[model samples]
Each structure stands twice: as structure tokens, then as C-alpha cells.
Target chain A: MHIEFEFSGGYGGLFAAKPLGYRVETDELPDEVRDKLLALIRDSGVLELKPAQATGGPGPQRDVFTYSLTIGEGAAAKSFAFDDASAPPAVRPLLSRLRELAVEQRMRP
Target chain B: MTFHKCNCHYIPPHVLGNMAKKGDPAVRQAARTSAQQAKLSREKRGVQAPKVPEMLTGIAMATAPAPVTAAREVYDCQNKWELRVKLARGEGDPEFGDDDVDTVYGYAETVRGYFAELGRNSIDNAGMNLRLNVHVGENYMNAFWDGDEMAFGDGDGQIFTSFAQSLDVMAHEMAHGVTQFTANLDYYSQSGALNEHFSDVFGTAITQYKLNQTVDDADWLIGNEIMGPTLYGEALRSMKAPGTAYDNPLLGKDPQPAHMKDYYNGPNDNRGVHINSGIMNRAFYLAATDQIGTQKAAKIWYHALQNLWPTADFDDAVEIIVESARTLVGDGVVPEGTTQTVRLAFKEVGLPS
Candidate 1:
């Protein structure tokens, strides 16, 4: 499975210059890391969630980070957009894990 | 029968009745007396009951149940994504001894008092309660205002620190509530940039007011105080000099544009709401340093904010802000030549574009 994650739009536009993004292949990860990422994706139920389920209606929310995630690619791909207020509980752990991975990967030479 | 001064005679009977039933004790007594006087006056003249206009009646009722004071409510999220998970503090309660909780409590008071000095009751100008949540999630690195309340995150301890530790950050979020009630500027394109600009305006204004700092004394950076050890001496945005706040590998360089010629015309950030705001923020900085002073310039901006509409653009803001300055000058709130000073400030930033 290929995973792509992007996060932006927080207070102070912290990511305005360069939004945090990551693309990783599950098969390329170490066994432990691969298992953890796979588990988070499974627990998130992202494949079953509709786009509408990721948003909490049109309302005023300020300075919240917006998240975008994609799994797989092309015909098998699933993508979702959500913000801090709209992200469902089940999706949060997956988002956190991806964030950590993105930071770690970025720091790697 | 002696007639008391019916100060509320113009108020419709139905509205006054509602106030009598629902108002605070003082308002209730006054409403009752006013209602009785109105009835007696009608009977004395043998006049038929006057028909109340629906709009007028609505306004009366809406403004009747006035909030006497703004209360503060602080919640601890306990590292959860959920909000208000636990009530950590309330208005007038003893100190919780938690730094985040106590710090936010005091900052809320300062923000409330700052607006109160301007005759604003609260965020809504109707004494709405202040709701805040701290410790939102594990290593959460942001803070936000979700229409009705605010939430702060303890940062990842590298690039940032506890967001609740910064007064300007709290004030910035609270000012969003004020903008929502006032101009209600659309959070896209120029209007969105204006929305962000107004929050920064109040954020720095309230900070300077609390710290007794003048234009020269203030650092004029938005998120400098929140920088953790790794990013110390850096900032998120620089109102004094846009696009110069920071430049590092972790967060990249600041992308703010100080002049309209360099305005970010991209689709990102709701059409550069945060990016384009640097233009206006620079205008404010120029005006403040040019003898108009920060608080006075803020008053002009606040007046414009109240008169502005949801879709108001940059040109509209410039015109309204200048007119507001003229009005304040006439009222002796700001000094003479303030309108010209404000116009020049905007001109420097390529405003009214």
C-alpha cells in the first residue's frame, strides 16, 4: 500500500511556506514500522469513510490545521480532506502516526 | 397618579414584558416600571395601543436580555482530540495552579478588559462567555477558534511551545470571534486576508496595551513568544517587516509579502488569507510608527471593521478605514491629520488595489 499525507493551514500559517507532506510505501518500511502503519490505517477505516463524513458541515472555524491523506494509487486510491474540528475520532490516530513519520522522514539525510 | 420618567416608553410593550420576565433584577424592575408607565400614559390620553413594527420589536427583544458580564470557562482536553473534556476552571474560581490554565485565565481577563475599555461588552459586544480549552492533544502544535470557543495545543517541544503560554496567541483567537460578530468577513480571498489582518491588529494591540509598550518598545512579531528552544529567536510573522520573521530548514522561510506588488495570488491558504495579510499588517505598522500610535490606529481599524460587510475587499477597507480615521478625528479620539496619515500608510503598502 502507498500512503500520501499532507498537513497545512494552522495558526500563523505555520506551513504556508512548505506544507508538510509525505509519501511512503508500506513494503519499503521495516517490519515493525510497516505493521504499525498498517494497523493505524486499518483502525482508521479510511477506505470506508465518505468524503462528507470527514467534514462537520459548513461553519466558522479559525486557525485549524487541514489534513489530506491518500491511500493506494490510481483506481484503487482513496483520498480525504479534513480539519481539526471535522476529523472523526477513528481517523485521528492514523493522522498522528503519519505526522510523526513525515517529520522523521524529513529529518533523515 | 405620579408618573415616573418612562425612559423605556419607546420600547414595545411585548418586548418590555419579556425583559420584565427575563432580565436581571435591575432590568426587570426598570422594565416593570416602564411598562406600567406606558400603560398609564396610553390610558391617560385615551389612545389606542400603538402597533409595533416587527423589525423594531425584534431588535428590542434581541437586545433586551443583555449579558451583564463576560464569564470565563476553561477546560482541559487531557490529550484528546475532543474539546471541553473536563472543566478545569470557571470565573472567579481559585487558581487551578496549572500554568496553562492560570495563564489563559489571566490572559482572558486582559483581553476582556482591553475590549471593555473600548466599550465592547465582549467578543459579541453582548458579554458572551469566554470558553477555552488547553492541552488539546499529545504534541499538538496549533491553536484554533471554533466559532464558539478556543482550543490550545502543547507543541511538539521542538519548533514551538505551549500555545496557551502566549497572550497574543490567545488574543488572536479571541479576536476572530470579534471579527465574526462584527464584519464577519468572508474567510477567502481579500476578505479572508482582511479577517486575518484584523485578528493580528487586535492581537498586537491588546498585547502592547497590557505590557505598556509603545510602537518603538514593542517587538511587533506575531508568534515570537511561542518559539521553543530549537526555534528560539525566530517568529511566525513579522508585522514590523513582513517576510522576515524566520528562515529555517524545519519550517521553511516566512512567505508573507509586505507590499501589494508582491501579493501572493495563489489558491493556497484560502487565497492567501494569511499571506496577503502581511500587506495590511505592514500598513498598520507604518501608521502606528508614524505618530498615530497603535491603540489609536486600532480604534480606527475597529470602527472600520464594524462598518464593513462580509464581502468587503481591500479597497473597501482602505476607504472605510480612512473615513473611520476622519470620524475619530472629528470626535477627538484620534489626532488631527489622522485620515491623511492612514491614507499614506495604506499607500505605502499598495492598498486600495
Candidate 2:
């Protein structure tokens, strides 16, 4: 499986304007990292969550990160959007791990 | 870490009544059970509900008497995504000895005191309590105002640091609460930008006041103190010179526009709420430096902020701000020609565009 992640929008546009992005192929990763990512993905149940469930509720949430994630590739790819304020409890671990990978990879435009 | 769970005791009877009437079959049954459980819990605690009309009960709940003085509550999240996981300290409590908690507590005091000087009781001007959460998550890199309270994150230590350490950041988030209670600006498009602009205005003004720095003495930069080693000396935005705060490979160049001609009309950042705010910020900087001073300039802006309504755009802001400056000038709060100075400052930034 392939994964793409982006983190943006926060206080003072520090992380915004130019969002941090990363793309990784599960097969290309070391065995341990690949297993962890796969585990988190399974735990997230991202494929099953509805848009309303994934996104934040109504009302203003200031200075919080907005996240975009995609899993798989081509026709099989699935995408999801959420923010730090309203990410579901089950989906948080996956988002945290993706953020770590993006920062470690130094992925940017 | 202690895991706080919501039980029947926390649900108000009015909410339970509505739920029992409107919820689905399973939800209705659960609501009824919860209501019964709540009554039992109240009796166990020796708390009794007042006998009143149903509508009056809701009114009383909604208008629950506010505290005469606001209190501060700081929670330690223990590097988890959850908030208020552990009570680290409360108002008048001894320092927790944790740097993050201690620093945030002090900053909260400074913010509360500053607002009091402006004749504001608290965020709601009703002595609303301040709830702050620190160490929010593992390598969390942001701080936020979630309408009711504020939360800070210990950054990854590469691109940012503990947001709790910044006084201006705390004041900025708290000002969002003030905006919420006052104008209640919609968080999108132009109105959203005004919301952001007012926060930045208060953030800088309060910081300057706390530091005892004049307009000439201040750097007029936001988020400069939070930058970690990798991005040291690079700020997130510069009110004095918009679009010039930062330029680097990691975060790209700053995208703020100081004038309406270069305004950002993109769909990103909630229609450029943070981006377009630079125009207004520059306008403020100009007015402050033109002898009116930051605090006085802020007073005018605050006056206008209270008068603004939801969906107010840049043009609406210009008219209201100028009117506010005029009113302050007439009252001798600001020096003569203060209104013209404000108008000229807005013209310099291409406001009312």
C-alpha cells in the first residue's frame, strides 16, 4: 500500500502557506516501520469512517492543524480530511505517526 | 494518568429531557436511564434541583451565576492527544515545578491582568474561568483556542518549542475568546480574517504592554519566539513588513500581502484568514508608529471590534474603525488628528478594498 499525508494550518500560518507533505510506499519501508504503519492503518478504520465522523463538528476551532491523508494508489486510493480539533479518537494514532514520518523525511515543496 | 470520564451526573436534566423526547428508540431509552441515574447521583451527592417551571429551569441553567473573579486552571495532557487529562495547577495553587505548567500559569495571569486594565473582566467580560492545557501530545507543534479554552503543545524541538512559554501566544488565543463573546465573527473569508487580525492586534499590543516596550522598541513579529533551532530568527509573520517574515525551503516564503493590491484571494487558509490579516496588521503598525502609539491604537481597534458583526468584511471594518478613532479622539482618549492618522494608515495598506 502507498500513503500520502499533508499537515497544514496552525498558529500564525507557521505550518500553513506551505504544508508539510510526504509520500511513502509500505513495501519500500523497513519491516518494522512497515508493520507499525500497517497496524495503525488497521486500527484507524479510515476506510469505514464517514466524512462527518472524520471532520470536526460545527463552530470555530482557531489555530489548529488541518490534515489530509490518502491511502493506496490509482483507482484503489482513498482520501480523508480532518483537523487536530476534531480527529476521531481511533484515527489520532495514525495521524500522529504520519506527522512523524513527514518531519523525519523533510518532505516539502 | 487519570482518565476523566463523563457520567450521568454531568448531564443536565434539561438536556436529558430533550434527548428522551427527540432521540431514537435506543437513544431515548438510554436518555431515560441516564436521567434516572442522574437523579440518583444528585441524591447521593446531597444536591437538589430547584423546583421551577421547565422553561425557567433552562433559563437559570443558561444564565448560571458567574463567578465574581475569574480563576485559572491548567491541566497536563501527559503527551497524549486528550485534553485536561490531569490537573497540574489551579488559581492560587503552588507552582507544579514543571516548566511548561509554571510558565503557562504565569502567562495566564499576565493576560488576565492586562484585560482587567482594559475594564474587561475576562474572556467573556463575565469573569469566565480560564482553562489551559499543556503538553498536549507527542511532539505536538501547535497551540489553539477551542472556543471555551486554550491548549498548547510541546513542539517537536526541531521546528518549534513549547507554545506555553510564549505570553503573546496565550494572549492571542484568549483574545479569540473575547472575539467569540463580542462580534462572534464567522470563521471564513473576510470576516475570518478580521477575527485573526484582531487576535494578532491584541497579541502584539498585550506583549508590548507586558514587556514595557514602545512601538519603536518592539520587533512587531508574531511567532518569532516559538521557532525552534532549525527555524530560529525566522518568524511566522511580521506586522511591520508583511510578506517578509520568513523565506526558507522548509516552510516556503511568507505569503502575506501588506496592501489590497497584492491581497491573497486563494481558497487556502479558510479563504486566507491568516494571510489577508497582514494587510490590516500593517495598517495597525503604521497607525501605532505614527505617534498614536500601540496601546491607544489598540483601544480604537477594540472599540471597533465590539461594534463589528458577523460577516463583516474589510470595507465594513474600515468604516467602523475610522468611526471608532473619531469617537476616541472626541473623548480625548487619543490626541488630535488621531482619526486622520488612522485613515491615512488604512490608506497606506489599501484598506476598504
Candidate 3:
């Protein structure tokens, strides 16, 4: 299964979005790394995340970034948004990896 | 080869190592724990933790004399969030025709005046110059101490006003600098909350000291003036009533907890540094208003801050504050009942006295 991600807010305003059925073969990543990453995503429970608040607090979130992620597509598609100020602990590693992927995608020719 | 550096910070390793050998078991354990954590923190920060001589029996390391004058610098980000923007004003510079610049410069001087009156050399106790950046980000609504200098935002015009408008916000950020120079409290978990707590404490202290307001007369609301007319809450955080700072349509209700049982356990907000600090903040408010006056309470808290380690937690805070108060009372620096008042205050906050 492939993952789609979008991010905004904060200083950088890094943003991205992907439609459903975006698939990446396991061969794209090393076997060990891919397995570990897949396990992290599976255990993250991202599929059940409800939509988070549009803004964090009454005060402006200077360094807080908002992230929206989708796993799978069509009837199985799940999307959730979280900000840097209040992102759940279990999903942090996944988000970090996705951020790296986003950066790599940006640098490609 | 990776160099293993001495982990102890602020306090020389030789001093703590000597305590580890000669002091009681508890002292030894604390020294060891501090050393270990310091090493880990150094590793994380990737900075060289200087190693001092194991046995400095009677050596006094040569150091430069501290500057006597306070230096202040303010910068304008020009609505950009990037740091190190153009220097708008410097020490003794003429006004830049900018309210935020003048406010930050004047406030820094005010904070410096308080510290000088208290016999503190500067933020680092070495006369480190105060650096401030204002108008950070387009409509950004927050101000923070980035471990070295202070940064402020203009705030979204609709929801919040310029952060520089509030004296307490400036004092609060500068107080973080003071804590950095003294305790260098780690910025995560309970220690992080303590760091925020000490900032808030001195934040209110500077405001009261400047305005010559008594504990009762003071509003005890942080960022009180920076709130826009349309915002829901009166202030960003309230020391008088921790959970009642603000609640409105644009901004959600304040989530700060006033007691230990209500402490947030989530992994967000750096383990709820801003949220749980309300407990200790209230403890100080209670101690200052009902028990001892703000002067004695501030002295006791400052002493306690100096006694705290980087990894100190809530219990450590209670213990140190009470001990500091008792010591001050014994020395006649504070009146009697100070320690009892401190204990009662902590007890009221659901912390062991």
C-alpha cells in the first residue's frame, strides 16, 4: 500500500497531497527497513484518526506544523490531520519518515 | 575516536565528583544521575562537555571579568519569520519609530534593572547582552525564548495583538534566559514544566516589581495585554486561576491543570509543559499572596532555582523551594512561617510538602 501526505503551517509551509491507489512496491525499499516502516505504519492506527482542529489554540502556533496523511485509497482510504504541537506519540516516527520522503520527492529531477 | 566528555554542567565535575565520594548516599546517587543525564544530553546536543581535572584540590581556574553594563539589542524581522534580521536598534540607539522595537528595548532594560537590583549580573550572570527580534512571521501569534535570545510575533490582527504590547510576555521570555543561566532546566517533561514555571514566576515578579504592585493588586495574567478584542480568553495563561485564563469561540478553553491529579499525561506539548505548569504556578501564587509576600517568595524561588538540576521534577521543585525558604528563614533573610507557607502552598497544589 502507498501513502499520501500533506503538511502546512509553521515557517516552512511544506505541503503535499496524494490521491488514492498510489502504490509503492516493497522492492523500492530495503527489505529490513521496509518491514520496520510497514510495521510502524500498521501499528500507528492512522486509519482511525479523526480530523484534528484547524488551528491549535487561542494563541498562534508559531512553530507548529499541521500534517494530513492518507493511507490506502477508495473505500479503504483513511485521512487524518495533526499538528506538531499535539501529534500523537505513536505516529511521530511515521510522520518523520513521511517528511523525509516528501523532501526526497521535492529534490527529484 | 569519540571523546567522552564530562557530563556535569554549570557545577564543575570535580565538585560533584568530590560530593559523590564524601557526601551521603543520596548525594552520591544524585551526583551520579546528574552526570549520566548530562552526558546523554551532551550527546544529543552534539556539544563538547568539557572535562575538568578529577582532583582540583585548590585550583582556581582563570576566567575573564564579567561586564558591568547591561547591553540590549532589538531587531526587526519586517514581518518575516527568519531570525537574525536587520538590527533595528542597539544599546543607547535612538528610537526606530517602531513601537515593538521600543517596547522590547525598554522592557529588556526593565528586566535588566530588576536583575541588577537583585544583584544579578545579567541573563547569564556574566552580563550577556539581551537580544530580541520582533514582528516575526506574517501574523504569527506567539513569542518564545529560543534558549539564547527572545523572539516575538505581531500576531494575527484579528485574534491577537503585537506580542511586544505585553510587559509580562517580555519578562516571561527574559526570565527564561535567567533560568538558562542559572539552572538550565531541560526543556521537556517535568523539568520542562519547571523551566516554564520559573519563567512565569519571574515574569510576574518583574511585572510587579516594575509596577510596584502588590500580589493582590497584580492581575497575575500572562500575556494579558496582548490578547486582541475578538479573542475568547482574557489572557494566554492565568497564574491566579490556572484553568481560567481564556475560553472563547476562536480560541479553545485553557487546558492547564491546577493540581497534580489533573496533570496532563499525553505526549504532546513537550509532555504538557505549558499545561501542567499551572499547578506549580498556582502554588507560587498561593505562597506569594496568602503566606509570604512576593519579595520573600521570589527570593526563595530564585534560590530554589539555583539549587535545581537540569532533570529536576515537580517533587524536586517542592523540596528545593521549601528547603530554600527554610534556609532563608534561618538566615533571617525571610520571616518565620515562610517554610510552612511554602509547604502548605505545595500541598494545596496536590504536591507533597
Model number with the top DockQ:
2
- Across B60-92, the per-residue lDDT of candidate 2 in tens digits comes to 456544443478899999998888899999988
Clashing pairs in 1: none
User: Top lDDT: which candidate number?
Assistant: 1
Each model's TM-score?
Answer: 0.85, 0.85, 0.67
Clashes of each: 0, 0, 1
- Please give the range of 10 consecutive residues that has the lowest summed lDDT in model 2 chain B: B1-10
- Colliding residue pairs in candidate 3: B233-B246
Task: Give the TM-score comparing model 3 with the true structure, all chains together.
Answer: 0.67
Comparing candidate 1 with candidate 3, which one achieves the higher DockQ? 1
Q: What is the C-alpha lDDT profile of model 3 across B211-318, one tens digit per residue?
A: 898988999887767767666357777898988977654334677889898888875555667777889999999999975878779899998887787789999989
What is the DockQ score of candidate 3, to 2 decimals? 0.05
Measured over all alpha carbons after superposition, the RMSD of each candidate to the real structure, in angstroms, is 10.2, 9.0, 11.8
List each candidate's DockQ score. Answer: 0.32, 0.44, 0.05
Question: Residue B44, candidate 2: how far off, in angstroms?
Answer: 31
lDDT tens per residue, model 3, A1-109: 6566755322111120111112344447778867876887877666656555222221212224456676775688766666543456566556656654554454445
Model 1 ranges off by over 4 Å: A55-58, B1-69
